[model samples]
Target chain A: MTEHVEAKSATLADELLGVVQAVEGVSAVYPAQPLWQSVAGAAVAAVTGEQLPLISLTEQDGTLAIKARIGVGSPLPAPKVAREAAAAIRRHLGNVPAVVEVLVAKIEA
Target chain B: MKTPGDALECGHSLAELSAYLDTGEIADPAHLDSCPECQAGLASLRRLSELGNELLTADVAEAGSGGDDWMQTILDNLRLELRPGRSIPLRAEDPQDTLWETEGSVSALIRSVADSFPGTAAGKCRLLGDITEPGAGITVDVEIAVVYGHAMEERAAALRNELAKMLQVQTELDIQAINITVTDVLELPAPAMTPNTEDQP
Candidate 1:
């Protein structure tokens, strides 16, 4: 039983990695970064007391960005969340060539 | 037992009933009557729809308002980077060393700091002039979104003061002037409790 559970966890992590790799302009998307994991967790916790879904941040040419598929898209022109997330990473890292991408894979069904 | 989304199978189909609700065009309208299953399914769907609306209301309530501390806390934790678009170079002691920051980085920092304030959020920010050249005249222009309840003039005034202080402390850019514009007004959340006067029984 313990072995089975471990396999399942590994499979889920792989699935998450696969999703991150699929987004456009994403050179690399791996497990959470130390800076982002701590800070993003705090930001999410402010809205929801519960722990948040794992969000991945990416970097592009000294610009940081986040990728999240939240499924709620309003039909209006506004600031893209992906760019905003990238901006957040840039703000934290100070012109580092790193982008933060937030992937919201699952929601409570 | 009738669950919320469960369809009643009174020798009829759930799909047909669902279609009827949307288009009012069912193949056999006469079969709906005298069919206990069909009636039960319709009632169940109706109840579920009502409950869904209630749930939506509750969710919006839970999201809270811009004035709420949850948003403030999130903005505070973000510690957003500034959006420095172009690298402005400054003369340094060594010719090999380069002193410059991107426009994207500076803008992001300005936004995050602006968003930290209650009833205020930052938008697009621009730096006018050749920042790469040392001693060049530079102007900081920023757009902001303010929550509806707060006075626009008051919010803008507060934002200017805060931005000036933050820029002076954080960056070494040659900022000649700081311009702020309130571009959007966020809707305020509804009051917590609505009056109910039917407790006389």
Candidate 2:
């Protein structure tokens, strides 16, 4: 029974390692702390009153990519943050527009 | 402060009523029962709050899931730049020329290591210590989100090992530590056309 459990654990670890290694620019992955959960949750709640934005940075074809959801208030304003976010991406990719495109995925209710 | 019209007509102030509505404190609470104006104002504010809640629900529904097409579209549009915050000296091929890599590049490398895991995603990342100076000790801290149901401890351990290996190979920052904080665990709905997509189609 112990051997079976150890083997299953090892398999899970190996699968996770493979996934982490597959991301283009990632050097590591780890469990989030409880404190971060509260702080980020509160911050996100204050901003949108909805779930927090899921933030991620990845490299696609040697260029960096950032993924997130931008919450807008009703009577939705022009997406100014969308533009600013794009600019931030541009700056990260060494001012390369070809390599960067800001994607806004709206979370479903 | 008291407004003139309500005070003159009914011996009651709209300002006082408004304050009372907000704070639930009134000098003459019973008088509000006879005041049609105060009742009307309170009703309006209550309705507005209800509408606000409805709008909030709608907007969140529109934000869609991380794996949803809305996110996919946004991701497609956002070409993020590498955060090379500092210039780390690299061994120059020419004796006089400086060979260097940016702190952004190293951070990008770290992110790549984290993203390699399925059901795991990376977030705001930071580098500790003065990355501007050569051979400065730097600690890498990263925020990440995992899909609900993924084994976090297992994933985290894998990421740590992978990053240690890659960072050791890539940069000369005196490595102190790598902190991974799971800031969120997202509940991604099953793949389908989100309501917005269906509307457009």
Candidate 3:
């Protein structure tokens, strides 16, 4: 049950990642997790045959918290892009409560 | 053709990009335009190259030749560190959802703004404050070099004001100050029209 829930959480985060990428002014999505987690995720994925997400999903105080790092394009304010991306993720979450964190890792202008 | 770029994460590196910028000899020119990683790498490498040129020009103009290894050293160090610095928080739609931007991205935006001014090339940029904390009073410290003939004070002042406004639009950091340091006086590069005059790759 725990493994199942964890996989489901990762999938949901990956789905939101796709949604954020589709948002306007977002140019690229980078790995939000630290190098250690990235390596661990890659290893676990190798065994489970699951495609891991670049973003991170954590359970904090009974809340599903998702973190994303992305690059924004020029001519559009990065703050605007980050807000739009976060909004898209929240809209996707719908009635299912989630804490979406969007980080603009780069501005590719 | 297949140069071993740094870590091969994108099959491209700053070193390879730097060589291409100098020699115009990439095995596949099409790759540069289509590959997003190469394009990103090129943008950063190009800007750094411009700054390197400024330093070298200043050296050549002042004494004689810029024969020292300083330029190479700078390039080596820069290529190693393309950090996406501190994550500065931004206001989100709800208290749960969070928004933020990295200091590196802000620096890139700042460099682009500085480039708009004539005869100015930006170098190291830093946000000196606890950017992770919301509404922190942040100071933007940027280094730039200008052509010998241009007015450094006017250009720096203009860049400072422009950076301030851009930061407000792009971030919520409190208005502390934007400090522009004139690092060196550069000699103007030769016209690009003479590229054909040089030996072809």
Task: Judging by lDDT against the true structure, name the best candidate.
Answer: 3
DockQ of each: 0.04, 0.01, 0.46
Q: Please state what fraction of the native interface contacts candidate 3 reproduces.
A: 0.71
Candidate 3 lDDT score at position A63: 70
TM-score of each model's B chain? 0.50, 0.52, 0.67
lDDT digits (tens) for residues B14-49 of candidate 1: 556656776888765654542323443454344334
lDDT of 3 by residue, B1-201 (tens): 444435224355676777898899876675454333455456666765665566565554343223434344434434433445567888887888778776666766776677556656666667888989987788888877566678888888888888887887777889698899876665544444745755887
Candidate that beats the other on TM-score, 1 or 3, i.e. the better one: 3
Could you give candidate 2's per-residue lDDT for residues A1-109 as a string of tens digits?
A: 3777546544543443343333333322222111133577557655775532133333447443433222211222112323444344344345432232222211001
lDDT by residue (A1-109, candidate 1, tens digit) is 3777546544544454455444333333322432223676557655675433334333356443443322112221111322333344344445444433442111110
Cα lDDT of all candidates, in order?
0.46, 0.45, 0.69
Cα error, residue A70 of model 2, in Å, equals 33
Candidate 2, chain A: TM-score against the reference: 0.32
Candidate 1 or 3, higher DockQ? 3
Which is the better candidate, 2 or 3, if ranked by TM-score? 3
**Worst window of 10 by summed lDDT in candidate 1 chain B:** B75-84
* Model 1 stretches with alpha carbons more than 4 Å out: A1-109, B1-84, B189-201
Displacement of residue B117 (Cα, Å) in model 2 is 0.7
